[model samples]
Target: MRTPTRFKAGAVILSAVALTVTACGTGGGDTSGGATADAGSGTGEIKVWGHQGEEGEVAALQAAVAGFNSSQKGVKATLQLIPSADYTKTVSATSPDQLPDVLEYDGPLMASFAYDKKLAPVEGLVSAQTIGNQTDSVKTQNTYQLDKKLYGVSMYDSGLGVYGNKALLDAAGVTYPKGLGDAWTADQFQTALEKLAAKDPDQKVLDVKENYGGEWPTYGFLPIVNSAGALAIKDNKAEGNLNSAPVVKAVQQFAGWRKFVDPNSDDKAFTDGRVALSWVGHWQYNPYNKALGQKLVVLPLPDFGAGTKSGQGSWAWGIGGSSKNGKAAGLFLDYLLNDSNVTAMTTANAAPPGTKTVIATDPLYKPGGPLQLFADGLSKTCGANPPTTACVATPRPVTPAYPVFSQQFSQAFLNIYKGGDAQAELDKAAKAIDQDFTDNNNYTS
Candidate 1:
């Protein structure tokens, strides 16, 4: 059995989730504290796990749960919001029978859970047509296939969009990259970086957020490689694809930003006027809007020879493989996905909606809204392919071996940014990833 390791926001895990159809008499709902807690009043325990630490998102979820609780005389669920540090290990360490009824997990890592039978096949529980109705990006992130069985459905979605500080750009006397296009060419991007750096010799010009380790590198840097025309993994091939000449050139180009990048910088750096350009997502929109006002702009990742790309996928919900109450849990999952609840979560999180219907009505994502750029969910397979000049995202590669792929790729990026050989590091990472594919039987397609 694979050991569940801690998720550093980059790591992923697998789970099995189910719901019980039977309804027990109503009882007072109780909060589950650390380790474990009482099941409360229900047919049986329907424990739901989430990892949102923010007060706003937590309150939003609690509100949704409260609604679920009031709507039923059965299946009172306790939302055990764990700290991210303790989350993955808690889920992985618990035996199948001990696992929670439902899991709120990072979408990218759902494959690992599916591979290990942590997630029950959701195909029969939810209709194929209903699942199909989800936005392409949201659907792709939560879907996990193993021997042709899909494991789960996402409750919501989130993605990153490149953002620029117009004031900083003007200070540097450079024009912001146009939205609705494939982003700037490599030379154009470099020229902009140079201009920004030159304008503030003592201040950092770019914040690639290298200080964030683990899965972040894959999410933050993989798009650059994708835009350079490389697939982290494709057609059971890893070596050539990840180590392609174009991919290496992209890494080289990113490394070239070393002089302008500040690894030690935090999110406030961009909003505080320390950096001219950076990568952030919708969650920061409120504070960013408050900080920079009209000067803040969402942008697409600059294209290399290909097109723009950026990261996608965020927290998603799934049923545990051994939940005693599969039907009830499924119902809760469905409740969480309801338009009103989904809107509540999106509104609280300040993120793009996970489904098209929600986005259609969401004022935040409506045309001319601050988050409209990210609301598009990126064009072309969640960054799996080169997209148009449109500021849509190119999400990270989805695979059962993502944890390993992310770890190795993260290390390699660290090396390249610190003056290590780009081709050599990527080549090494690719070899390791390909071997993992073979060991895992190419995810047993």
Candidate 2:
């Protein structure tokens, strides 16, 4: 389990050619240049790769790998740590030799890989009941592409939440908001922010100065949009309803709260601790909690409007398509998803457990903490894959250009939040999206 930190904007560009080479098998088959029955046996080596993290973060995975190696006399497993900065590029560019028998991949990247057929289905390897029964949303994310074929297994669970400074709230004489199930409506949430800000008129509460609160406007505001019944994108199409009645109403309400908080600067608002609540992820538990010392209180993002749910994001582990050791990879994946392994990882990483059995038994989860809120939100949230067209198509093809599309969407939302002409910005973004879809032959119209 690894709590993900933000990545730098520009790192390394992955060459498609390199990816192709790495993904396809090299001509030489074995040590003797011929296919052999012991290809994946102890005489052969299996490479496994994933992002690097804190020492204890991957202990569970290491333990599981150790167990597999000790129990199976046929195979030897080797681990490779890829820096998060180049992880996506490196994974996407895997040569047959570079590709791991089993690997961990972020969910959106996994979706893209599935679209490209760079991943192999794990349908027969693990029972849907075993994985699916753990967390329906995770199962949905894992099989979100290509006719619901299982491409990966969820290693752990995580969701967005508000990391509050309890002392700050107490100092402001404000009450902590309820869990997602009992989250505050848009107006109610704003009112809380306003009250917190008013307690110290000269102090800042919410940050929006830099890039107009780019990060928060995306994650924090997403659920509000959903609660307001606005869809960011529907059926691979960008929706202008972002400025529609419900969405605009939600934004306006949020903007009002922003005014009371740091209407001018993003840094001062959050760092000053005048902001009683900061929208963040479950992975931020350690760093943020440590920053606040004993002042931290984790809570779900406040629900806005009448909706009973919130939006969520999750990650999973996927097996590379180019690997020759499918059997061994499957066994490794099975061990990773077992309740004990999942629990150990999530607990160490400060993330929520993805499986039902793990979540139920994990000691890290308190009865009414943010983990419970995430479990509740998962039941209501929608995923980006399997696409809205899955109901009509068999083995749906998610556009290979989804990452580009997501960037455009993020930019458009940024423009709107920055006080740009909302309708105009949306129209521009819609046009670009339509063009992208059409150029890729992924659009319906």
Report the C-alpha lDDT of model 1 over 245-364, residue by residue, as the tens digit: 988988898788788876643446677778878765555567777888889888877777766666777777777866656767767777777888888877776666776677777888
Candidate 2 per-residue lDDT, tens place, 1-445, comes to 1111341111112334423332232322211111111124323567788776545656767887787678767667788878754676676665534567777766544445655445667765556566565566666556643355667777665566566778777876777666554555555666667677767666556543333321233443555555565555555566564445666666555544545545533334444566677665555556665567667775655554545334343456766666677766666676667777776677777666777777766655546553566555565445543212111101111344445544555577666666766566666766776666565445221
Q: Relative to the true structure, how large is the alpha-carbon lDDT of every model?
A: 0.66, 0.55
Candidate 1 — what's its lDDT?
0.66
Which pairs of residues collide in candidate 2?
19-93, 22-94, 22-95, 22-96, 23-94, 23-95, 42-74, 134-356
List candidate 2 stretches off by more than 4 Å: 1-44, 95-98, 127-130, 166-176, 207-220, 240-245, 260-272, 287-296, 306-311, 366-370, 383-399, 443-445
Best-matching candidate per TM-score: 1
Estimate the Cα RMSD of every predicted model relative to the unseen true structure: 8.3, 7.1
- Per-prediction TM-score, please? 0.85, 0.78
Best-fitting candidate, scored by lDDT: 1
lDDT of 2 at 87: 71
